[model samples]
Target: MQLTVPDFVGFVGVALVVGTYFLSQMGRMDVRKPLYPGLNGIGAILILYSLSNTFNAASFVIEVFWLVISAAGLIRALLLKSR
Candidate 1:
């Protein structure tokens, strides 16, 4: 088979999301850090972009939620930093 740009984007997105989780699990990264949710939000955006081409309803829905949650985490982190 052939690999397209969207495919590559999706793979990177998946990697970022999974890598972030793995780092958090191993305590290499802090969940409260902006970088954590920042990477997650970026990954979700890339995934959503890839989905625009293939169009999977389930994956799209889940990614949307993931993006939202990541955004909330980022905001919370910023708020805490301000305190």
Candidate 2:
């Protein structure tokens, strides 16, 4: 198997997004805030993008479930903040 430019780009993008989330969670980065919603959105987008290159039914279902749960949490947080 060979790596393509798109694959490299996608991997880099995902790494950055996931790394940012972990950094924020660990309290390592203050300026670069990794909000839950933002992280979830990025994750969802990345997973969707990856589906095009290599599709997996099981993985797809799991990712979709994750996206839905994350979105719900984010929405709840926003609502709480607004109140």
Q: What's each prediction's TM-score?
A: 0.96, 0.65
Residue ranges of candidate 2 with Cα displaced over 4 Å:
9-34
Residue 22 lDDT (model 1): 99
| Cα lDDT of model 1 by residue, 1-83, tens digit | 78779978998999999999999999999999889999999999999989877899999999999999999999999888889
lDDT of each: 0.94, 0.66
Regions more than 4 Å wrong, model 1: none
Per-residue alpha-carbon lDDT of candidate 2 for residues 1-83, written as tens digits (9 for 90 to 100):
89765566557656755776687679875422226655765676676667768778886687677678767767777777777
Alpha carbon deviation, residue 20, candidate 1 (Å): 0.3
